[model samples]
Target: MTHSRRSLLAAGATGTLALTAGCLGFALGNEPLEFDSDRVAPADETVAETGYEERTVEERTMERTEEIGGVERDFEASIWLSNYSKSVDYMGQTREGSAFAAVSVPGMEVAGQSVNPLDEMSNEELLTEFLGRADSDRGDIENIQQGESFTLEILGESRDVDTFVGESELEGEPIDVEIKLTSFDHEDDLLVLFGVLSKRFAAESANVELLMESAEHPIDT
Candidate 1:
């Protein structure tokens, strides 16, 4: 995975909010979460049919601060993430495609917000934070056109997700792309999936959806 794209995904992972009305009363903890990359990521055989190959799966630690009762508290959060990508030569040019999944710490409260910012955050706020990356000049994605919200099955459950269409520059060449963004609870953590594929191939390919569907939570042994 490219450094710029990795950084973009890391930023998006940190900005994700998983709080909901049912979770507002949960206690806050300062201890960092733990994750096993193998258990959280999809199997290689599963990714094979998706067209994109699994590039990397690892644990990431991020630092965040929140103010509570006028006191500043720093928190270290853990994310188990995976990157899938593929490259195809088309019309004498190389087109790049990618997708990412990050498992979020359940009940982690974001900074600058009250006790339970996650629960208080609206759909607009959450989507805004997730999609904000598309507007970054430091990132390759640009000219984002957000589409409607709908429900889809992920990790065996139906969840609301948003779709986006955009353009990105790869090695000085422009490529049209389609994106799907969704977050849902699985086991004890919240999983977020951000998928992007070449527009030309998206219609004819179900790779992105296949990648998501094939993921497993690493059943306990």
Candidate 2:
């Protein structure tokens, strides 16, 4: 999200208050939360495709907040770059949330590397093959107790996800918020992008969608 200088000031004001509340012990963290299946459904169909067979680009900006360790942190604005090609498509998603931001490219591959390693495997196969190793390397998802924090989990080289949580105080009231980003590769027909940008900051989430829509490189039909 492109933010005027004025908007940054407003976001800072909101963040300052949240930080204060956190310091006062008004917020706390929760255990590793399970993914809410009802809140997020897998994307089963293509949303939009370019007619031309050449590379294309799109851009968007948004501002939002998330709950981390129970405290709310504000994101002023963010940018992203999505590029697509014939052999493979890459969507680079980024956001400046809280104390830090990250950039991720989910559909990347090397000459001998696999695209969708589990393409021929069932969900159970995929989980047993990929996640079993990951869980061994990274401890089981545990709850975080601090207020306003971030966590990044590398599910695999081809798939990874991150989440940020914070608490927001607006108009003398407290509100919980969370933002998450999850991306992974699929079969040749498509790629997968999953993430959440929520809170009173509407622009933060919009920026993410804007970047996806304004991908610079597109697949060649």
Candidate 3:
């Protein structure tokens, strides 16, 4: 069953790209949700608010192990969340570029396959494309008429790949999310994880434009 799940995940990566195009034209729903930066404080604040009873950052190391396709994979993840944004660092024992960071909502899970941002493209180009697509589809339920799964193809300077975008509602706010997984040629038993975390920038549909303008590197270190 584990092997099968891994296989399904792999296939899902490819299929996500293909389905994005069709999903881009549908209306999913239009229930607005409130997004208060204060609702979910950052890791540090959460710890403080909890009276420091929880584990400290120095003591906490997020890790998960699983066997996929007859191979054992171990993942260690660290997260830093702030009022403005969130970042995650994922490391795998066998992957070449074992480390990568994503800017998103705090406590977001790393799902799907892994992708290397240092591949043949630049971060600015990649982020630009991501924000552009999200902007084009902002507040438009027509893009999500076919359930919550959809994929879109994004063109880059030297290469192009399909990206899967998923949507959900939280606290009356619309949540737009994406995941990209790619296999590295150098590693036979490793996969890359690429993810996007986003919410409506504001009450109006214009917030998409702000997010595009404000998007930056999730992790500085």
Candidate 3 lDDT (Cα, 0 to 1): 0.27
Of the candidates shown, which would achieve the greatest TM-score relative to the real structure? Answer: 1
Segments of candidate 3 deviating more than 4 angstroms: 1-62, 68-73, 85-204, 218-221
Full-model lDDT, candidate 1: 0.52
In order, candidate lDDTs are 0.52, 0.28, 0.27
RMSD of each candidate relative to the true structure: 10.5, 22.1, 19.9
lDDT per residue as tens, model 1, 1-221: 10110111111244443343332222133332222222355556867765566565556655555554343444444555666667677668755555545344343533334222343454444545544432122245677777887776767788777777778765566878677776765664555666666676664236666666666774332
Q: What TM-score does candidate 3 get on C-alpha atoms?
A: 0.23
TM-score of predicted model 2?
A: 0.22
Model 3: which ten-residue window has the lowest total lDDT?
31-40
CA lDDT, candidate 2, residue 171:
33
lDDT tens readout by residue for model 2, 91-149 = 34232221111222222111222222323543233323322121111122222122232
Candidate 1 to native Cα RMSD, angstroms:
10.5
